[model samples]
Target: MAGNAGVSKPRTAAPAASWFGALEPDHAGDSGDDGGNDAAHSRYDRGEWRASDVADSRFLSRQARRIAESGQSGLYRLYRAFVAARAALGITLLATEIAFAWLITSHPQHGAALVLCAVYALATLALWLLPNLLGPSRPTVAARLRRRQWAATIGVDLLAFGGLQLLGGLLNYTALLVLPALMAGVLTPRLQALGVAAASTLIVLLATQWNAGVAGATPLLLAQAGLAGAGLFVITLLAGELSGRLAREERTARGSLAMARRQAQLNRLVLEELQEGVLVVDRRGRVRAANPAARGLIGEPQDSSGESFALAGVAAWEPLARAVDRAFAEGGWPEEGRDVLLPRDQGPRQLRVRVRFTQRREARVAEDYCVLFVEDVRTVQARVRQEKLAAMGRVSAGIAHEIRNPLAAIMQANALMAEDASSAEQQQLTRMVGENAERLKRIVDDMMEVAPGLVPTPAPLDATAQVAAVCSEWARTVQLPPGAASPLTVELPAQAVGVLFDGEHLRRVLVNLLDNALRHGSRSAGAVRVWLGVADDLHARLGVASDGPPIAPEVERYLFEPFFSTRSRGTGLGLYICRELCERYGASIEYGSRGVPERHRNEFSVAMRRALLPDSESRPHLGP
Candidate 1:
């Protein structure tokens, strides 16, 4: 009885600590108390086992609670299932005893056996219906009263079976003892399970001895009871060992599942943020998953959710679908990527598509998929051009430094020789030399502006008035008619709009754009138009558009590139310098067709940062 009552001993802490030690080594030594045995006993009696006796104890309790919540949830569920099974077994045993009693009406001990079965059935039913009546459902609480619980459950089973056996019933009741023994083995520690088996053996021998004294039992009956007790011990040991192994496996599986879920979420987040388009496609040309970049590249609506589309359904994407099919047929793809054209109403777009097959663990060939890495060919070329331009800028800066001194000396010599000239022919020749020297100096200055360390110091200026003044001066210089009928048309905003830009730099950028427009536009009224307006609340737009033929595709590719020009005498630094200056003042310059469809005109527009106020003091210097 003492051994049976020891089932409720608090042994869960040792196992919980051992399992958590590997994960939290720092708290492995914590025993929920720091002062020793006396303090531990005192805290236990006061229900303060989880109190923070020390700093480590607090942290250990928290870690233990978290482990109990997540790791032992499945264990608690299994325990409840076992309890319900016990109830079902009790009801079956009761019905069996009643039927046996009805078959044997003259049996003397039938009434006592029936009464015992009914009481046992009721006890099991109550336990199952209200599990928490014994104590709280938490494992921690259950561990505290395990002895009382075992006594109430398995002890009653032993006593009831022993009673029926002693009453000399026709049905052998010894085999019925296996239920409690198995339950003890699974739910309790190994030692407790063994103790239940030993108690059952003792009950069997005592009952047999009492029967022999009362009804003259045989040796065969004694041997059978001994062998049956031995079988109970074997079953208990095996059940206990198997249950422990299953628990360990359950914990391991749950941990692995949680880690896999986290990894999948991280992979999704990274794919969504990638700049290159990623598409997962199967052999049937069905797109299983597509990232935001892939959707944009395929011209799919971003707001659409969950619905998947096929690449082969659209005519423009048929080339991509065919490429996917070819890859599947060949069992491999080119590592350098394959170019596929998507011809649209606007223009044909080129995409570099690369494929990598997924290696699935299963043997199903239909489950195989390929990941496509899509990149725009134009974007690739732009990145290459940017790198080349960086290298060229460095070389140009060095050459400009070397040419500065020689160019200054030539200009000085030309000026001095002009003063000494005696003939008008010599004077004209000196003037020509001076003009060419100045042009070379301007070119050198433009190259120097491309130096990376240059920063802009901006002040607020009226962009509307500035555009009007620059356009009027340029029209007169080009010998166009004055006033509203001039070929150079200037359109200004109704109100003065201030922009952040250096005064002289703004003038230079506007003049460069106007010169390009006039040189390319037809020499007629309203052919070259300059306009200033507000693009947005935070920006002011200045545009120079011309009624000229569309720029050739080959030339347009390098429109703003330094030293790239179509005319033999043109330097091609005008547009490049304009872009650099605008960038220095937090502005942007781009070339596009700006007019209506029938009168599409080549336009160079600058988007400048709007000033906070129309005062130079209020303007802040911009950074590049």
Candidate 2:
């Protein structure tokens, strides 16, 4: 952990050198002054350096961060932009120079200086500007000018500087201002199409300088600058070529990495999409990787590195890790790896995940591992339950049928015995056997109700009239015992709720519904209501409604399910059969437990498609 601590011997990572007056920032809170240079403290400002540090994050805009991250964009675009900016500045100066030569005569004293200065600025501007313009943009204008125009344009600029130096002796020393123009070309240790600029600057400086000694030495000075610029240009060109080669190599590497990543993704997808959930963990009991289904079956991934798997509650992964560790420690699995029960917030999921030595014989690295797969056992459990129920149903149905014939025969014998009863004991026995046999007959009939496709017969009728008739008949047969007056009420829609209907089926369904209301809702009040109507003539709907006790939420859930009943006196097929028969008649029924939110009144309604009244010619066919 030593960082430039002056410990005499360095650690693994330490600064080898410093540049740009910069010293290494201290680590572990020591500055290492030793009084060698007090100014070293100022050179390295930890806080300021940290402010612009890549980890600071705030300094970079989204775009800047993206460019830094993405290897997709080449640096060529950045270089093109740099060239364009320099070119624009240089061109503006060039135009100014040509104009100034014509304007400076009025101020005759400043005339030579103005022309020289303007010309130099113009030349500098050209060197910086034109290359950017020519290289990436407008390579072929009219005919093609290519990069040759760039080199030629720079040469023309240098010659203009030279021509200006000759035009006015000593006065054109103003052109020295253009020397800084060389900085742009040699700015970052590279000069392309800029050798002429340095040569031109030297030519002007010597030619136009007033001092004879300096003027005489001009050619040699110019020769040195030209040589420097030429050498620098060669270096720049070589560096650019190297950068291009490196970029091409990097791009190829990136493409190969991308293909490998896709193949890995496809392999992972195969594991994830399987019905069996899979979790792979290392020796540390941490989830190394899992699939989409597994994440959903277990929990969402909270660990970005997938190494904190115990927190993820992936139970199967822990055992797999142990199994793999054991397999590597020994040789093979112990008892085919134990069954792992991975629990989740959803439910306790049981997985019969097993482990074996991972087949990696070809891999050069250590590869002994285990694979754990979790299969859902809920469906298997459900199927076993259904098989048990079916077996019971078959056994019960057979026993009930066998007892049915004997029960009928006993009832007939009891009737004959009642006629020959001699004393009270014999008479009582006859009545008891007959009553018990009748009860046994009822149980047998319920068993017979389980027969297949025993649908209630449907016959077309005037539904409105049929409803009225059924209500009258129910009132006659099942009335309040003696003197209690709870009137059975019947309401009907004024319009005919015509439907392609079943008369007998409607009677039987309404009878069952009325019985339910009385048995459930009217038990306390001893009153019931029946209503028949057309909810919608457009869809040909006929609706029947009854009043009863509100069906509680628990009861409402399975109210219509076959063999699901709340009544103590009868089988649960009443509501279920009613709905099935209605559907067969091209109708549907909706049952609700409350009139409104505040009131709890059990209500059942049967609705059917209306039978269309036939046309004039067709009407005669029904007349017979």
Candidate 3:
């Protein structure tokens, strides 16, 4: 009985650390208490392991709970099924026993035989009904019930057959003993199953000798007993083999299911982290799958629970829906990605959408699905623009070098012509040629700012003094209306505050800003102001404000774009060159429109790297 019970013990997998070896992670790896465990330290220091290295703990705990809730042993299920089959066989056995008791001229104890058959039928019915009442329980409870049922069925079968044969029964009835022996073989261990077969065979030999009224054992009877034992042994071996195979298959299936689930989780993680928008839509236009990127691209709120984006609800979505439909109609991907324009309060925004078609099989029917990818047009355009500018810069640099020599020759020749000309008109023409050549040279120099090799040499200088000097010089050079009190006002910090910038580059940038402001600014008293102050701990701020008409938003966007200008005579490279120079020296420039007490003004602000100052205080110099 002990051997038979041992057969029910579940086969456990080998120790995770042993079989997994280098693949397994030790729980003690993170602990410092492992003073003697060299293996643990070695593994931790190597640190070449996968996430699943800890699956012994994580996967096993989860798998255990899952199995407890739903898993059943194959042997238990087969045994339960066998008990049900026995119930049907019981009815047939009862009928056969009733006919035999009446038809045969049986001796004493015929009534006992009939009563045993009836009791046997009742036992089979009880066993079959018991499982339904038990429903599902833990593995331990199921195993207990299985053992109880096995014992009861075997006891009843042995008693019935043994009694019938002992009571002068004509039929051999040895064949009936094989059923209980067979059940024990499959559900019990090898030794227990052989014991059952041996025990039944002994009972058969004793019953046969008694029924035949033999004084001693006969050859025929002995041969019959041996044959019955051999048949029982063969049945036991086959059942054990089948049950072992079933257990192995179940183990393999569970392992495969675990691997598949882990793979699914990995795929989900990658999809969520992707930058590109991804959407999967079915033929009916219902979104089946969407990543965070896709949700953000559509301007949909995170809390919105709508499953499908209706094409008719918004005009902006119609183009995307149509592109998806077109991909489906063509039974492939679209030749070109669709460009969509969405209107917003700021302006019309551009989006580029591409669609790919896929076929999915559901219930043996193929259904078409479209995967839509969305990308912002500005992002794509910006990347393309940068590449184009890089190539153009290289070309422009080469051209600038080539043109400088020719321009110098032209200027020198025109200068010589001015000395040689006799007539006033001829001299005036020569002067005009020199002026235009100088202007062309300035344009080339401005354009060359975009050249990749242009690097600024920054130096530490007093920002307050520089701002005061530049503003005063600019006002004098522009020669503002003399009668109208000076249009320029200077605001500088008291103490000596310094910043890192190329003095020459800074001067040129200030001059370009002042020149542009003068052309567009109001010629009223105190209309222009330049202020210098600390922007932050890291930067020194210089701002130049002009009481000029506020720049239109449309024009402001391209203000610093190379070759873009509002004035007909303007080179369009002035502001661009200023920004380039500022950037090269670890500084930045930006423009904004502001309104003062009496006038609206456009302001240009520059932020430069702040230089460290000494602790000693010097007298403050107030500048106007």
Candidate 4:
């Protein structure tokens, strides 16, 4: 009965460990406790051995569950089939015994016929009841042993039939050969072939011995022997081939299940660790899956009433939920999240919702379940906003201190000039005071936050092309020191795929970088490389390099600080404002020098997320 089950899938160590408590799962091996007789730590347990554990280990638990559930029926069916075949064999034997009794009475061979009937009846009865003892709950080893035992006994029937044929041979019995062939059609092909081969060899030898003095072996007998051997051999080959195919199929399905389970486990782990509240709902709006996150924002417990239903403490939640439902129906998310004003204990608290959906891929047989993924975006946004504000506060205070002293000097000098106490040189000195004062104020003003609400524009803009335009502008007005030259270089990819960004803002960003290259990095007879490229499909990157005096490490560390400078005439807000503006557009800037030895050189790079553009029709309908 068990052998009929064929190949089986491997089991995971985790669930077993949870149930037994003794199995310590690890990367290299499964180390179980041998401390006591407790089932969890039993040393004698056969289940502890991990012979082919890796063959079926899935990171996902859910996928394994699905496979296990579906496989149960197939396994049960195999056992049932074994039991049925045995019952049918028993009935055939009983009828054969009755017919033999009638034949023995007429032929006067009662003793031999009676012995054959007894052996056949006992074997058939054993096959019939064999499956009952080897039920599903039996341990794997026990079940496998039972299957081998019964399967072997079925082969023993061939020996009995061969003996019966030998009895007939002593009496020139040709009728006894029919029993062996009938056995071939009923038993597992492996067993049938072995049985038939044994019977044919013995029976043919006996026939040869009995007919040795004849002209030749009877033609009809030779033909029958050939047909029997060929039939049994072909059956065995086909059965062996089919069994191999079935085993391969079993392994593949098990592998897919293992992978699915492992993935599910990882997803579950990430879901539990997530900081934001998350909840999943099906297409009918029924809650399907939920992580450690709360049902509602700010730790609200979820309530379910069986059917698809929803509730929110805030009225705004309805519209947001509706949007999520629409996105799920649409099959992909266009927008991930949006902030909502939800009522809190104190007052209205800001919260954001991000939702996505995926249908159960394997459950196509029952495609009603939809996996809705939900996350609270409020926490992420709040953290980002707080960091940006703290940065601005520090910059504002520093700029205030830097600009105050210069402002007082300019005001006092202007008052003296108002009294007409001025020679030509005195007037020039006052003019110098006014000029330096304007520069200081400009620096402080530029140090302020990048224009209040500039974000990546929703329209597509080409970063590479933006850098090219800035390169042209730099070429026209750039100046350099002796031995240095303005390098005109822009590496624009052949394909100009645009991203969602404000053209004017990106252009300004490029202009600042280009000017910095000309001012601090431009080199003559030295390599000056500039590249505007995309990195890893996620970020747009721009790097400008030059072989000039390398920037000192100490200065590079604080180069982006507002009002920081190494140049005597610089406003000090150039690099600082450039960085602040880039951040406003979801960009970052990094500065570094080339080599540490002789030649002084630098690289200034900027990066930003590759933005996604809306449809062309929604973007002012720009014509081709």
Highest TM-score against the true fold, candidate: 1
Record all residue pairs in model 1 with backbone atoms less than 3 Å apart, i.e. clashing: 7-147, 8-146, 8-147
Candidate 3 clash pair list: none
- Candidate 4: regions farther than 4 A off: 1-84, 99-104, 127-154, 166-217, 294-321, 324-333, 336-351, 355-380, 386-624
Q: Please, what are the lDDT tens digits per residue for candidate 1 over residues 154-244?
A: 7778888778777766777788788778876766656667878998887787778777786766898788889989999999888767766
Question: Can you rank all candidates by TM-score, best first?
Answer: 1, 3, 4, 2
Tens-place lDDT digits, model 4, residues 343-417 = 556676665655554543344443444444444454676678668866876767577667778687777778678
The digit string of per-residue lDDT tens for model 3 on 484-586 reads: 4877767777876778886767888988987887677786776777788887888988888888888888999998877789978887888888899888888
* Local distance difference test values of all predictions, in order: 0.70, 0.50, 0.66, 0.52
Off by over 4 Å in 3: 1-23, 27-276, 301-319, 341-350, 358-367, 377-391, 416-423, 454-461, 475-484, 614-624
Q: After superposition, how far is residue 498 of candidate 4 from its true place, in Å?
A: 59
Number of the candidate with higher lDDT, 1 or 4: 1
Which is superior by TM-score, 1 or 3?
Answer: 1
Lowest summed lDDT across 10 adjacent residues in model 2 is found at 1-10
Cα-based lDDT at residue 116, candidate 3: 76
lDDT tens per residue, model 2, 385-481: 6688557556757888899888888888889889999999999999888877886786666555453445655544666667778877776677544
**Can you tell me which runs of candidate 2 are displaced by over 4 Å?**
1-386, 419-432, 453-469, 480-487, 495-509, 523-526, 532-591, 595-600, 605-624
Against the true structure, whose lDDT is highest?
1
